[model samples]
Target: MSRPAGPAPLLRRILQRGACAALVSGLLLVRQGRRDACSGAAPLNAISHWLWPESALRQCGLSARYTLVGAIIHWGASCFWSAIYEGHRQAGAPPPRARPPSRRPPAPASEVPSHDLVNALALSAIAAWVDLVLVPPRLSPGFERHLSDASLCRVYLAFGIGLAWGGARGRRAHRLPPGTRQLHVES
Candidate 1:
């Protein structure tokens, strides 16, 4: 008789595809929004300044170059945190025993829930939005001419690319035998 495919593997594949889609779509939308915002004269320069206060430190304060650096830094940090969280989940291990006589209990399902890659990607996208739409604006010039929609879109795109890269790495790691299975001791 032919064997049935395991649900776990199927789920993993689905999750991976979802993650890729979310990362791409979220980024594109953010970029488009940024572009639309920057095309006007009373340019949202305040928003740009707010998103990148560090640019204010430059002698020629608020140049595109300096703002770009800030955007890159922001996106980079968001990607780093998402990857770190996903890595932790992927590499987590069950409790271990130190003695031959030890009787360990099986881990509860709640404690060993399957992680969905799509969820991770979605969260990463949310983080990117928070950084660009809320955090930067509140902390910086609050709506400068440079804070054009285009600039914000580029920032989101960078964040999305980072998230996609991390997700790909995580998917590969998930495919490894070590990452796919978990061990637990039972009494």
Candidate 2:
């Protein structure tokens, strides 16, 4: 048996993990919201309630405007983290050993897997559904509330941190061999 070449395996694993993470996160948020509601806590808001689904967004002090703001924050964070990871990988090793001098170079190590675009979009949709469709129906009338702006900002920060951490891990795992000369040979 022989290992396959290129990034097919790596891509598959990333997609699998991304999907699993999104599913697990969604389920946990739903469960927490239900538990909090049952305990008489305020219900979380539709757009800004990832960490504590049971708590009302109103209590957190966020406005409806923060929803769009948070989305923008998330997108920027993802891009930033992805770039950092790719940069790190590029810096880690020598160029691949074998190559046509005129050929284009491979992508940087920190680059997000192309498959991740789909995963990111799917995860975003899942998050929206959890916040909007699922949480609202389960919330009691008294639970509907908005989060504080500060609290929403904090959540965005945490989300950014998570993305950075995941990007770093991916970059570390996918390091291509350094030294272009070492990678290929003229037969």
Candidate 2: TM-score? 0.30
Candidate 1 error regions (>4 Å): 1-30, 33-35, 39-64, 87-116, 125-137, 140-165, 169-187
lDDT of 2 by residue, 1-187 (tens): 3344446544544443333333333333334435443321222234333433444344433344433333333343334434443344446648656545556665666665655444444444444344445765543222223333343333333333344335445554545555532343434
Q: Give the count of colliding residue pairs in each prediction.
A: 19, 26
| Cα error of candidate 1 at position 113, Å | 15
What tens-digit string does per-residue lDDT give for candidate 1 at 21-124? 33553354334435544422212223344444544332232345544444444334444455455455556745333557437753433231224444454555
Q: Count residue pairs with overlapping backbones in model 1.
A: 19
Query: Considering every candidate listed, which one attains the maximal TM-score?
Result: 1
Count of clashes in candidate 2: 26
Looking at candidate 1, the ten consecutive residues that score lowest on lDDT are 39-48
> What C-alpha lDDT, on a 0 to 100 scale, does residue 55 get in candidate 1?
41
lDDT of 1 at 124: 50
* Top lDDT hit: 1
